[model samples]
Target: MANPSRVFAAVLPAAGRGFAGNEKEQVLEVHTVNRQSPGDRVREVQVTGTAEVCFPADRVSVCVSLGNSKESVAEVLSSVSRRLEYILQTLRQHGVSDKDTVVRRYLHRAADLYHMDAEVVATFSDFEKMEQVCSVLLEKLDKSVCVGTPQFYHSAGCLSQLRRQVCVSAVENAQQKASEVSQLLGQSLGPPLVVREEETKEWRNEDGEFGSRGQGAALLSHLPHRPTITASSRVSVSFSLRDKSRKQL
Candidate 1:
């Protein structure tokens, strides 16, 4: 039976609507469907096609966190604050500005030793600046303020633009795919009956992860930046079949 629900959100609460045993009923229905024999299978499924397009990021947001531990919270924060100030200086020297940077987090945790963790972030004029920033931190932050490295991001405006561009490209890609399939089947592409969307997340500065140091700790050589960012999307679209005698959907 076709689900009357229009959206995924609608389906979730559909069974929960002011019922005493709604969850149990839903479980039973799910089990019943699982046990039911295979009814109709669409062997020739027209997968809604997917298209990917990459757009250069105009601005990048990054988060750089620093942490250290001593005794008192004041001592911890003061140590971190100095390192952070130096980092800001390094970035500014390389053409990055305070306006392009923002402080993200400042917190203290009770550990074996006194500790301070700070999250300072900056947007680069160019992505290459990120490399220099990291390098400077690795070199300058010696025996103090353990650097957690920087995280990369794209602004919402950039993401929104890509979504629109990718969506249009996806629709065209679907049409081309359906047309090819139709031709191979000795038919013409019928007007599309249904369209759906799928997307994959990706990162802005896909540059490889920040370099790492070998095993064994020497002040600040054990922490490695685990940079895993991938943006990908998949779409599936199907066109209805129509003959000269049949009307288009």
Candidate 2:
């Protein structure tokens, strides 16, 4: 019997050859190299793996708008300023720091009415304290002050950390999948050859399939019961493989 693990070279004619000079003018080409045995073939497997992580929202931003209309610009400014001061004082009394508050004042004349508006923004880590501040503004403060629903989002630092952790988990999942596939093929999983991250998607679990709140009005009524933020990471990984027969030998 002949050894199957042999490599041979063969010569063949090139395509589109015609007689140019004398008889039997042709072109010779070398092509079609194949391994005599299946064991000589190189193997690589590509797998895509995804991982998702969920965490509760850690910070909240409370937005409040106050406006006053008066006969004189000075009077409207004074009233709005006083109300804004009171709102700030109330926030401080509830443990909100100055660094966490933002205030903007605007004045304009509309149809002989001196209009003054103030927008106040504050961020809080404690939901109870935030709720307290909002309640006080709506109940104790004058009706001139308007409050908008607080928008909920995860902290930037928290999201950054989650992305890193989820990417690692996704790669691990890819490795596990590759190992399973290698086992099924009776091959040993070798070192990874390539790694590529596909994408990372993050959203609130309460949003359901609505995606972002800015997408449409259809998701306006759904409320998040869990205040949970979910993140998913996808990765494509290529890994080399070693034959089981070689390992056994």
Model 2, C-alpha of 107: deviation from truth (Å): 3.3
Q: Best-fitting candidate, measured by lDDT?
A: 2
- The C-alpha TM-scores of every prediction are 0.41, 0.59
Please estimate how well model 2 matches the true structure, expressed as its whole-model Cα lDDT: 0.83
Which clashing pairs does model 1 show?
48-235, 48-236, 48-237, 69-114, 70-114, 200-232, 200-233, 201-231, 202-230, 202-231
- After aligning candidate 1 to the native by TM-score, how far in Å is the CA of 97 from where it should be? 2.6
- Candidate 1, residue 44: Cα displacement in angstroms equals 19
User: How far is 160's C-alpha from truth in model 2 (Å)?
Assistant: 3.8
lDDT of 2 by residue, 1-249 (tens): 333444455554456786566655445554554445655556899999999987777788888998989999789988889889999999999999999999998898989899888899999999889888988999988586887777767788988888889999999999999999999999899999999999999876765334465756455555423267778999999999998777454
**Ten residues in sequence with the least summed lDDT for candidate 2:** 1-10
